[model samples]
Target chain A: MQLFFQHLINALQWGSFYALIALGYSMVYGILMLFNFAHGDIFMVGAYIGFGVATALAALAALSALALPNWVILVLTILIAMYLTSFVGMLVERIGYRPLREAPRASAAITGLMIGIILETGNLAILGAQRIRFPSLIKTQVYDIGGVVVTNKKIMIVVVSLVLMLALNEFIKRTRWGMAMRAMAFDYVVIPLMGVPLNTIASLTFALGSALAAAAGILFAVAYPVLDPYIGITYGWKAFVAAILGGRGSVKGACLAGFLLGFIEIFVGAYLSSSLRDLIAYSIILLILVFRPHGFFGEPHSAKLRL
Target chain B: MRKGLLLVVAILVVGLALSPCAWAKSKTIKVGINAPITGDIPKVGEGSKYAAEMWLEDIKAAGGLQVGGEKYMVEIIVEDNESKPESAAKAATKLITEDEVLAIVGPQASSQAIPAGEMANNYGTPMISPWSTNPDTTKDRPFVFRGCFLDPFQGPVVANFIKDEFGFKKAAVLYDIASDYPKGLAEVFKEAWENINGPGSVVAFESFTTKDADFSSQLTNIISSGAQFLFTPQYYNEVALIVQQAQELGFKGPIVGSDSWGSAETVKLCGEACYGLFFSTHYAAAGATGATKEFIERYEKKYGYTPDDVGALTWDALRLVQKAIEDTGKLTGNLKNDRVAVKDALAKIKEFDGITGKMTFTPEGDPIKCAVVVRISEKGEFEFYKSACP
Candidate 1:
C-alpha cells in the first residue's frame, strides 16, 4: 500500500507534464481541424528558451549579487520563456500554416512535419551537439508523508499545472475572445460571417496552446534538468496521443486522459515487468480507443451535408 | 584544335611531373576515423576525433612512420557514422575501398563498431574499436581489435566490487533491453553477482528501451524488492535520468554501474543524486599518472574539459596501431598484402603499457587490462576509488 502511494505521486507528476502539453494539442485541434504536429517541437523550443533565461538570470544574480530567492528566479524564467515562445508559436502559424490554409489539408499536415524537422535541426545547429543541463532553480527537499516521499519539485509541478489549467478554463468560460473561439470551432464558415476576425482567433489559439506547452516544458526541466534537442520528439508524440485519447476539443477530457496515461504506464511498470511497460500501457489504450473510436468525450460524427 | 591539343599535352605533363615527385618525396598513409559525430552521443565521437588528431600531430611532427627504411607521412580521413549501424558500415566501406585507408579507428559504441568491424574484416584492413567492449566485436575476426577490456572481464570486476567492498547480498538490475552492449553487460553481471553472493541473489530484474525518459515504474518494483544495491549497465544519458528518478522515488540504496556510466554528462544531469554511486571503468580521471595524466591535461587544455575513458582509450588505440605498423617493418606497396601484414603485427602485440594501463590482448582479440572502480563524490566529480586487475 505504501509502495502504491509512492507510485501514485510519481504518476501525478508525470501526468502533469503530459496533461499540460496535451491541452495545447486538444485546443489547437478543437479550433482548427488540423492537428498542430509542430506543437511538440514547440515544447522543446520553449524548454531551450527556458534554459537560456534561467542561465542568464543565474549569471546576472552572481555578477550583481542579487539576493533574490531561487523560487523568484524560477518564476521569472517561466514567465519570460512563455512570453517569448508565444511569438515563436505565432510566427510558425503565420509563416507555415497561413500560407497553406486554402490548400489541401495534407499540405498543411506536411508543413507541420517540415516545421518540426526544421525546429529540431535548427536547435541542433544553434546549440551545437552538446546536451545542455538546466540549472536547478529549487533545491530538492524530500518530504516523507506517511512513507510516501514527495519532493518539493514534484509538488510544485502538480500545483502549478492545475493552477494554469484552471486559469485557462476560467478565461475560456468568461471572455469574449473565448466566445469567438467557441463559435469558430462550431463552424469556421459562420465565424467570419459574424464579423469575428478568424485570423486573430487562429493566432490566439496557437499562442494560448504554445504558452501552456512552454509552462509544461519549464516544469519538466525542473524535474529532469538534462535538456537535449531531440527531447521533444517522443514526448510530443505521446502527448499528442493523450490529446487524441482525451477527445477533440474537450479540455477536461485532455487532462483526464493525460493522467490516465501516467497511471497506466506507472502501474504497468510496477505490477508487471518494466520491459513490458510500453507494450502493455499502449495495448490498454488501444482497447479503450477500439470501444470508443471517437475518444472519451468526442461526439459521433456523420458526413456533412454537401452542397 | 591546336590549342586543345596543347592543353591536353600540358595537363599530361603536369600530372606526370607531380606523380613521381609525390611518391619519391614522401608517400602518405591514410587511416580512416569512423565515429558517431552527429547523433545522441556526439561527445563520445568528438573525444575520439580529438584524441586521434592529437596522435596524428605527434606522429607528423616526428617526421612520419619509418617502414623498411622509408618515411611515409600519416594522413587521417574521418567519416561521421551518424550513430547508426548501417551508416557505420557504409562509412567503413567508403574508407576501405574509396579512401583506401590502411587501418581504421573508432565507431565507439558497440552497435556501430560490430557492423563496421565485420566490414573491416572483409576488406582485410585492421580496425581497432576504441571503446567497444562486447566480446563479439572480435570473436572470430582476426582483423578486428579493441582498446578496452571486454564485458566478461569487467562484469566480474563490478560484481566482486559489490560483494567484497560493500558486502551486499541482494542486487537488482535495470537495463536497456534494446541495447546489445548494456544487455550483455547486465547478463554478465547478474551471473557473476549470483556466483559471488549465491543463486537467487538478484531479486528484481527490470528492463527499459533505449531513449526511455522515465524509470519511476522500474524503481518502484526494485525498491519494493528490498534491493541493497542497483546495477544499471547503461549509457550516461539513461543512467543520469535513472539516478534522478530513483532518488525522487526515495530509494536510498547505493547504485552500481558499468563503465558506460563514467561520463562528464552523468554528474551534470544526475546532480547531487549521483553522489556515492559507483561504477567500473577503463581509467579514472582522479589520481591518474604517467601518460594518462599528461594526456588528460593536454585534452583538457585543448577541449576545455577532462578526457573521459572513451578519449583515453582512443588515444591508446592510435598508439597501438602505430606500434603494429612499425612492427610490420615493410608495406610492400600492395594494399591487400600490406593490410595482412598490419593485422599479423597487431596479433603479435602481447603486452603493451598504454595510458589506460598495461594492456595484453588475449587470443580472442579482447584486451586484458586493469579496470578501475570510481565513485561519484558529493561535489559531483568522478573520484578514483580502487583498481581491479586480471
Candidate 2:
C-alpha cells in the first residue's frame, strides 16, 4: 500500500509536465486545426528563459539588491519567463505558421518540424553543448508519511500545475475570447465570417499554450534541475502522444490522458520491469485507442470534419 | 642572362618549400590527437587538447625529443572527432593516411575509442586511448593501447571496495541501457556483487534509456527492495538527477558510481547532493603528491581549473607515446616500419609511472593499474579515500 502511494505521487508529478505541455498542443489544434510540432522546442526555450530569469532573480537576492524571498523569486521567474516566452511563441507562429496557413496541412506540419530544428540548433549555438543546472529556488524538504516518501517540491509542482490547468479551464469557459476560440474549434471558416478574427484567435491560442508550457518547463526544471538543448525532443513526442490519445481539440481529454499516460508508465515500471516500462505502457494505450477509436472524449466523425 | 637568373630563383623557392617535407620524414615526430572537440562531451576533448598542448610545451622547451642518439622535433595534429563513432573513425583515418602521424592519442570515450581504435589497428598505427575502459577497445588489437584499466578489472575493484568499506551484502544497480559504457559496467558490477554475496544478492536491477530525467519509480523499487546501496554508472548529466531523486525518495544508504562520474561538471551540476558520495575513478585531484601534484598544479595554473581524470590520463597517454617513440631507438624514416616499432615498444613498456597510476602494459595492450576510490568532500573536491587493485 505504501509502495502504491509512493508510485502514485511520483506519477502525479511526472504527469503534470505532460498535462501542461499537452494542453498547448490541444489548444493550438483546437483553434487552428494544425498540430504545432514545434511546441516541444517552445517548451525547451521556455525552460532556458526561466533559467535565465531565476538565475538573475537569485543573484539579486544574493546581492541584497532585492529583498525578495526564494518563493517570491520563483514566482517572479515563472511569471516573467512566461511573459517573455509568449512573445517567442507568437513570433514562431507569425514567422513559421502564418504564411503556411493557406498552404497544405502537410506543409504546415513540415514548417513546425523545421521551426523545431531551428530552435534546438539555435539554442545549441548560443549555449554550447554543456548542460546547465537550473538554480534550486526552494530547498527540498522530504516528508515521509508512514512508509511513503514525498518532497515539498513535488507537492508544489502538482499544486501549481493543477492551478494552471484550472485557470486555463476557466479562461476557456468564461470569456468572450473563450467563446470565440470554441466557435473557431467548431467551425473555423464560418466563425471568421462572423467577425471572430481568425488570426487573433490563432495567435492568442499559441500565446496561451506557450505560457502554460513555460510554466510546465519551470516546474520541470525545479524537479529535475538539469537543462539540455535536446531535453525537449523525447518529452515533446511523448506529450504529443498524450495530445493524440486525448482526442482532437478536447482540452479535458488531453489533460486526463496525460495523467493516465503518466500513471500507466509509472505503475508499469514499478510492478513489472523498468526495461519494458515504455513497451507495456504504450501497448496498453494502443489497446485503449483501438477500442475507443477517437479516445475518451473525442467526438465521432461529424460535419465539422468537412473543413 | 635574365632568363637564366629567373629560372635559378624559381628553383630555389621550390627547394625551400620541399626541404621541410624531406626533414619532416625523419627529423620530426608527428602525433595525432583525435578528440571530441565540438560535440556532446566537449569537455573531454578540451582536456585532451590542453594536455597535449602542455606536453608539447615541455618538448619544445627541451628543444626536441632525444630518440636513440639524435634529437627529433615533435608536431601534434589535433582532429575533432565530434564525439561520434563514425566521426572518430574518420579522424583516425585522416590522421594515419593523410597526416602520416607516427602515433595517435585520443577519441577518449569508449563509444568513439572503439571505432577509432579499429581504424588505427587496420592502418597499423599505434593508438592509445586515455580514458576508454571497455575491454573491447584493445581486446584483439595489438596496435591499440589504453592508459586506464579495463572495465572488467574496474568492476571487481569497485565491488571489493564496497564490501571491505561498508560490508554491504545486498546492492541495487541502475544504468543506462542505450549506452555501451554504462550497460557494460552495470553487468560486470552485477556479476561481481552476486559472486561475492552469492546469487540473488542484487535485490533490484533497473535500467533506463538515454535522455531520461526521471528515476523516481526505479528509486522507489530500489528503496523497497531492501538493498543497502545504489550503484549507477551513468554520466554526470544523469548523475545529478539520479542521486537527488534517490535521496528525496528516502533512500538513506550511500549511492556509488563508476568513473563516468569523474567529470568536473558532476560536482558542479550535482552541487551539495553529491558531496561525500564515493565513486571509483582513475585519480583524485585533491591531496596528490609528487609528479601528480606538480602536473595538477601546473594544469590548474594554466587552465584556471582542476584537471579531471580525462586530462590526467591524456597527459599520461601522450607521455607513454613519447616514451614508446624514444624506446624505438630511432625513427627509420619509413612510416610503416616506424609505426610498427612504436607498437612493439608500447607493448614492451613495463612499470611506466603516470600521474594517474603506475602502469605496465598487458599483452592485450591494457594497463595493469590500481583504481582509486574518491570521496567528494563537503567542499566539492575529489578526495582520495582508498586504493583497490586486483
Candidate 3:
C-alpha cells in the first residue's frame, strides 16, 4: 500500500509535465485546427531558457551588493524564462505558421516538424553536445508519512502545476480574450467576421501555451536537474498522446488524461516488468482509443472532412 | 581532342600505378584514432583525442619513433565515429583501407568497439580499444585488443568488494537495457551476486531504456524489495538522475556503480549527491605515484581538469601500440608485411607496465590486470579506495 502511494506520487509529478505540454498542443489545435508539431521543441527551448536564467540569477546572487535568496531566484527564473520563451513561441508561429495559414494543412504540419528539427539542431550547434546540469534552486527535503515517502520538490512541483492549470482554466472561463478564443474555437472562419482578430488570438494562444511549457520545463529541471538539447522530442510526443486522449480542444480533459497517462505508465512499470512498461501502457491507451474513436471529450462529427 | 584524351588517360594510369610504391617508400607511419567526437558521449572522444595528442608531442620531441636503426615520423589520423555502431564500423573501414594506418586506437564504448573490431579483424588490421570492457570485443578476433579489464572480471570484483566491505547479502541492480555495456555488466553482476549469496538473492532487477530521466517506479520497487544496495552500470548522463532519484526515494543503502562512471562529467553533473559513492575503474586519479602522477599532472595542466579513466587507458593503449610497432625491429616499406609484423610483435609481448597497472596479455588479447575502486571525495575527486585483482 505504501509502495502504491509512492508510485502515485511519482505518477502525479511525471504527469504534470505531460499535462502542461499537452496544453500547448491542445490550445494551438483548439484555435487553429492544426497540430503544432514544434510544440515539443518549444518545451525544450523553455527548459534551456530556464537553465540560462537560473544560472545568471545565481551568479548575480553571488555578488555582495546584490544578494538574493535561492527561492527568490527560483521565482524570478521561472517568470523571466516563461516570458522570454513565450516570445520564442510567438516568433515560431509568426515565421513558420502565419504564411502557411492559407496553404495545405499538411504543409503547415510539415513546417512544424521542420521547425522542431531546426530548434533541436540549432540548440545543439549553439550549446555544443555537452549536457548542462540544471542549477539546484531548492534544497530537497524528504518527508515520510507513515510508510510512504515524498519530497518537498515533488510537492512544490505538483502544487505549482495544479495552480497554473487552475489559473489557465479561470482565464479561459472568465476573461474577454477567453471568450474570443472560445468563439474562435467554435468557428474560426465566422469568428474573424465577428470583429475578432485571428492573428492576435493565434499568437496569444501560442504565448499562453509556451509560458505553461516553460513552467513545466523549469519544474522538471528542479526535479530531474539535467538539461539536454533533445529532452523534448520523446516528451513532446508523449504529451501529444495525452492531448489526443483528452479529446480535441478540451482543457479539463487534457489535464485529466495527462495525469491518467502518467498513472498508467507508473503503475504498469511498478507492477509489471520495466522493460514492458511502454509497450503495455501504450497498448492499453490504444484499446481505449479504439472504443472511443474521438477520445473522451471530442464531439462527434466535429472533425470536419476538408477533403 | 583525341590526342588530348589519350594523354590524360596515360597520365591517370601512370599515377595509379606509381601510387602504392610511393606510399610504401614514405617514412611516416600512420595510426588511426576512431573516436566518438560529436555524438552522445563526446567526452569519451575528447579524452582519447587529448591523450593521443599528448603521446604525439613526446614522439615529436624525440624526433619520432625509432624502429630498428632508423627514425620514422608518426602520424595519427582521427576519425569521428559519432557514437553510433554503424558509424564506428564505417570509420574503421575508412581508417584501415583509406588512411592505411599501421594500428587503430579506439572506438571506446563496447557498442561501437564491437562492430569496429570486426572491421579491423576482417581487414587483418590490428586494433586496440582503450575503454571497451565487453568480452566479445576480443573473443575470437586476434587482431583486436583492449586496454581495460573485461566485464566478467569486473562484475566479480565489484560483487566481492561489496561482500567484503559491507557484508551485504541482498543486492539490487538497475541498468540501461538499451545499451550493450550496462546490459552486459548488469547480468554479470547479478550472476556473481547470486553465486555468492545463493539464488533469488538479487531481490530486484530493473531496467529502462536509454534517455529515460525518470526511475522513480523502478527505484521504488527496488526499495520495497528489501535490497541492501543498488548497482547501476549506466554512463555519466544517466548516473546523475539515477543517484539523485534513488536518494530522493528514501533509499539509504550504498549505491555502487561500474567503470562507466569514470567520466569527469559525472561528478560535475551529479554534484554533492555522488559524493562518497564508490565505483570500480581502471585507475584512480586522486592518488598516484611516479609515471602515473607525472602523466596526470601534465594532462591536468594542459586540459584544465583532471584526466578520467578513459584518458589514462587511452595513453596505455597508444603506448602498447608504439611498443609493438618498435618491437617489430623495422618497417619493411610494405604495408601488409608491416601490419603483420606489428600483429606478431603484439602477440609476443609478455608483460606491459601501464600507468593504470601492470598487464599481461592472454591469448584472447585481453589484459590480466587489477581493477581499483575509487570513492568520490567530498571535494569531488576520485579518491583511491582499494584494488581488486584477477
Top DockQ prediction, candidate number? 3
Q: Poorest 10 consecutive residues of model 3 chain A by lDDT?
A: A298-307
CAPRI class of candidate 1: medium
lDDT for predicted candidate 1 compared with the true structure: 0.87
Candidates sorted by lDDT, best first: 3, 2, 1
RMSD per model, one decimal? 4.4, 5.6, 3.7
- Candidates, ranked, DockQ: 3, 1, 2
Pick out the ten consecutive residues of candidate 3 chain B with the lowest summed lDDT.
B16-25
Give the alpha carbon lDDT tens digit for every residue of B30-73 in model 3: 99999988777888999999999999999999999999999999
lDDT of 3 by residue, A122-217 (tens): 998999888889999889999999988999999999999999999999989999999888888888888799899999999999999999999999
> Candidate 1 on A1-307: residue-level lDDT in tens?
9889988988999899889999988887787777889999999999999999999999888787786778999999999999999999999999999888888889998999999999999998998877777898888888888888889999999999999999888878889988888777777777699799989998998998999999999998888777888878888988988988988777888898998998888899888878888899999999999999877877665112110
Candidate order (TM-score): 3, 1, 2
Query: How would you encode candidate 2's per-residue C-alpha lDDT over B255-361 as one tens digit per residue?
Result: 99989899898998999999999999999998899999999999999999999999999999999999999899988889999999999999999879999978787
Q: Which residue pairs clash within candidate 2?
A: none
lDDT digits (tens) for residues A86-135 of candidate 2: 99999999999999898998999999999999999899899987789999
Per-residue lDDT over B251-298 for candidate 1, one digit per residue giving the tens place of the 0 to 100 score: 888888888887787787677878888999999998888888999998
In terms of lDDT, which candidate is strongest? 3
